[model samples]
Structures are given as structure tokens and as C-alpha cells.
Target: METTKWLLDPAHSELTFKIKHLMISNVSGAFKNFSAKAETEGMDFSKANINLTAEMNSISTNNEQRDAHLRNSDFFEVEKFPQLKFTSTQIEQTDDESFNLHGNLTMKGITKPVKLTMEFNGIMKDPYGQEKAGFLVSGKINRSDWGINMNVALETGGLMLGEDVRIQCEVQFVRQGINVPVEV
Candidate 1:
């Protein structure tokens, strides 16, 4: 079996998360710098090995003050942990297009097993004749599990930030072999 490698198409890939703020509305954020790669046997992604990493310092919420607070000791502690990572341990096909992706997520020096849903958006050839694949990954995790338990008590009797964080990513990968330059 020939091994197939997939390189992340950074321009079309995004890592974003949302959490309830003020116990009322959701706050969205994204990691501006992140990367993912996968290896499979002849494009069989069912058993592919996937790895992803996001730079802590690249986190943004569209608000500098909030973003800075998230990067500090009250949350991610970017100075101590520069990156968070995820490595797939297993992938179970739930159907022809959906799968259960189980992996170990490491953040803030803590590692935890996480299960995420992945929807394979099929593969196609780009205008440059490069093979490309797309996927949508979604999941939720408790922030406190990784030591990001910062929050302020509201007068209304609820925490300022929600504990559960919803993660969503639209990732595109270009099959290696074609040397065509990807134009975002």
C-alpha cells in the first residue's frame, strides 16, 4: 500500500471556538496560527493518523483586552505553554461521510482523551490539478479540565464565562505529490 500524505491548506482551514459569555451570549474566538497534517494508506482516511497544533499566542477574540486576558495566567498562560496539540488515536466510521475521531488533547501541560465528530466532505481536484480533501470537526470540552478555570462571579449569581467550550474547525488538506503552489 502506498502512503499518502496530506498537507494543511492554511488559507482555507480555520480553528475556532465559542463559549457562553456573561451567561447570556456566546463569544467566538479563533487561533490565527494553527496547522494539521494527516497520513493514510492510499487515501484511506478511516485509519489515518492526524495531528494538529495551535499556537497559544495566536488566539483572538476580536477584542484585545479579552484576548490578552485569555493569554495570561488566568487562562491559557501562553508564556508557559506556547501550544496545544491533538493526536488522533483512533477513527471509527459512523457512516460513509461521518466518523468518530478519538484522540488525546494536550493543553497547559495536561493531556486528556477527547472524542470529536468529523464529517468528511469528500475529495476533489483543484484548478491546479491538486487533489484536495475537506473535513468539518466539532466537539466540546470543559475548560477547567485543562486548568483554565478563570471566571468572575456575577451579581446575578452565575459565572462570567461558561465552562464548556464548543470547538469547530473547517479544515482543508492538499494531497502531497503535486508541487502546485496553493493560492489561498
Candidate 2:
């Protein structure tokens, strides 16, 4: 029943995100090189530590020119910072299968409090009897807050690349040891 110390099943996990682009719509993207780590014991999911790292240059939004510009000094400036990291400051349960993931998200030399609205999508076993847990984490961040401001003015109205960015993560993790039954 220990929900603590559960390893992040890298093979089935993902670190994805989306950002507001112009006042018209949003541009979705993700970090190709990223990892999620967590420590859990049992039904008690409190005080667990979680960390996630993303490679700076691996940012993508399906467009080559825009993606290249984002890597430049006006945006992420991948050459200088080189990494986006998040470390848990505090984690507590909101319900049986959900928690409030509070962490310090550091990017481009700016450290800010980010709350990842987390949902524990339950645990299950495969045909091989390996226990697995799934989670969907989401949060919003201001691009200008991290000094990533590079926008253009439209002939009709507002500038390109909106300030608020909505990020979401759909991650799945597999337990490495013991076939323990989850209580909550």
C-alpha cells in the first residue's frame, strides 16, 4: 500500500506543453528530452518529492522558422540557460487520487512558484503483472515573467505571441518493484 518511492516509468512518460501565440490562438509544443522523478510510499501521497528537467534546445512547435527563433537570445536563449528545471517545494493530497504539486520552476534565470494541478489517474497492472500509475499535470505560466518576450505587431490589431502560456503533461509511470495493492 506504499505510494511512496515509486519510480517514474520513463518509457511511458511524457513532458509536453503549450503556449499562447498571438491573440488568435495557442501554439502547442513539448520537450523531447525530459524526465520526471517521484518518491511515494503508500496511500499517503503527502510530502513526496518530484523533479522534472527539460533540455532547452529541444523545444518544438512543429514550425521550423518559429522554433529556430525561440532558441535565439530573444526567447529561451538556449546557449545561456540550457535547461528548464522544476523541483518540488511541497506536495499534498487534494483527494484520494489527486494532489497539489507546488514546485519552483526555474527558466532563463527566473525562479517562480508554479502549481501543477495534478490528477492521479489510478494504478493498474499489465499482462506481465507490472503495476502502473498515470497522471495528468497542468499549469499556466506567463512568458514575459521569464523574459521570453519576442513578439510582432499585427496590421489589424494586437501583437503576436501572447503572454500567458498553458502547459499540460500526460504522464504514465510503472512501478519497478513489488505488486502492491493501492488502498485509495
Residue by residue across 20-125, what tens digits does model 1's lDDT show? 9999999999999999999999989999999999999999999999999999999999999999999999999999999999999999999999999999999999
Model 1 residue 74 CA deviation (Å) reads: 0.1
lDDT over C-alpha atoms for residue 40 of model 2 = 67
Estimate the TM-score of every prediction: 0.98, 0.86
Clashing pairs in 2: 2-41, 2-42, 3-40, 3-41, 3-42, 4-40, 4-41, 4-42, 5-40, 22-161
Tens-place lDDT digits, model 2, residues 70-116: 89998998999999999999987888878889999999999999887
Candidate 2: misplaced stretches above 4 Å?
A: 1-3, 177-184
Q: Give per-residue lDDT, candidate 1, residue 60.
A: 97
The residue-level lDDT of candidate 2 at 43 comes to: 34
Q: How accurate is candidate 2 locally (lDDT)?
A: 0.79
Clashing pairs in 1: none
**Backbone clashes, each candidate:** 0, 10
